[model samples]
Target: MKVEIHNVFKNMRYKFFQTEDGIYYIVEIKPSFWKTLFPFLYWFFPFPVYKVEDEKTIEGIQTPESWSFDKSSAVLATGGVAVFIATIFRGKIEMFKTELPLYIKIIFLIVMIFCVFLIRLFVNKVKFHDLYKHVNLKQLERFEIKVKPQSFKHIGQMFASYIFFLFFSVMSYIMFFLDGNVFVLIGGAAMLIMFSLVVNITVKEGLTKIEFIK
Candidate 1:
């Protein structure tokens, strides 16, 4: 059977199918408009999905083969862009109370990406950290959904992110008035609003209970 699932905003769609052998496989993932436009920031992230074996896999899902190319492309494109920006604005941008060179900034960005990749790999091991990932055949068959609240540490991290976005938005607004960079204005507003919506969803999902009935 096929079904459509969406998040709180109902902007993106998760298309999935359940086979006779009781395995759930995603057929297609329709990203939101924002994600489609800014694929560099959103599309590269790894989302959790069931480990597909040879017998029960579907076509359109992010199989290992397809994801290899996608991941490489995203990393290369992002790194290239970061290096280009750093090189162009080397003396203009300041860091650690001084202006850093192009090579140093590029190295820092690469290190940050590597650290994030490692952290995501670790998070994928835990089952209940993300509710959406638990929509597998085994969980559905048992009709038991595990809902875990965000840890205080995680909540603190999110709050920090919220503040960071708020700052970025304000700074971008000021800079736009000064120089009128349209890209900066659009990006800042988008980041601020998206992070706000995420925090809103996190706050509202407190102790949500789900039960599947026959």
Candidate 2:
């Protein structure tokens, strides 16, 4: 079955179908155009094929509670927006008068791009648990269906990230010590943390594949 993905920018479709063994799979049919255009905006964000273990039947998805500025998500969104705006206007600011090297400029640009996505990441309020709404409870036959886990698809992409970020983090630490550039140090720290996460996930994913094969 096809379900309309909730997109603020454009209408897109997500495919969800059931198999003979009572397994359900949800796959992306048409990705959001904006996401395609700006891949960096959603980098490292997981869009996993969920496994539903519970036998409970669900009706349509219920709307989540309204967002409040007092919440931590709201604070993160506001902070990301502010940092993105500052990055855009950094050239005009008096404190940043000294022109940065090309590599540093590129690093800052990448960080700024991440900031843009940070806002979206925090502001997005979707509850994946509620995604069972795709299954119609009214259809009595659907009640017996239990969704099983699917094999991973983006393991290669994650491994590539691990390589790139490992090199980047090493160079960042070296450059920071040599030139005493605090910005580079900060960027390096962030990339190092990201690299560690990628390594951990990649290992887990590899083990999962081995288990699946067994």
Question: Model 2, 9-126: lDDT tens per residue?
Answer: 1112222333345654332322333543333323333333333333332112212245223578877997999799778867654443345676875686566446645643442323
Model-by-model lDDT, in order?
0.41, 0.42
Compute the lDDT of residue 121 as modeled in candidate 1.
39
Stretches off by above 4 angstroms in model 1 are 1-62, 69-80, 89-157, 178-183, 186-214
The number of residue pairs in model 2 that clash at the backbone is 0
Error of 1 at 145 (Å): 7.9
Over 1-214, each residue of candidate 1 has an lDDT whose tens digit, in order, gives 2222213222123323344565543322223435333332322333233423433224423233423236788889989997998798677543213344556544644554355445433533332233244344344322212222245654565557657766776776556445544455555555555443332222222232221223
Clashes of 1: 0
Which regions of candidate 2 fall more than 4 Å away from where they truly are?
Answer: 1-20, 23-53, 57-155, 199-214
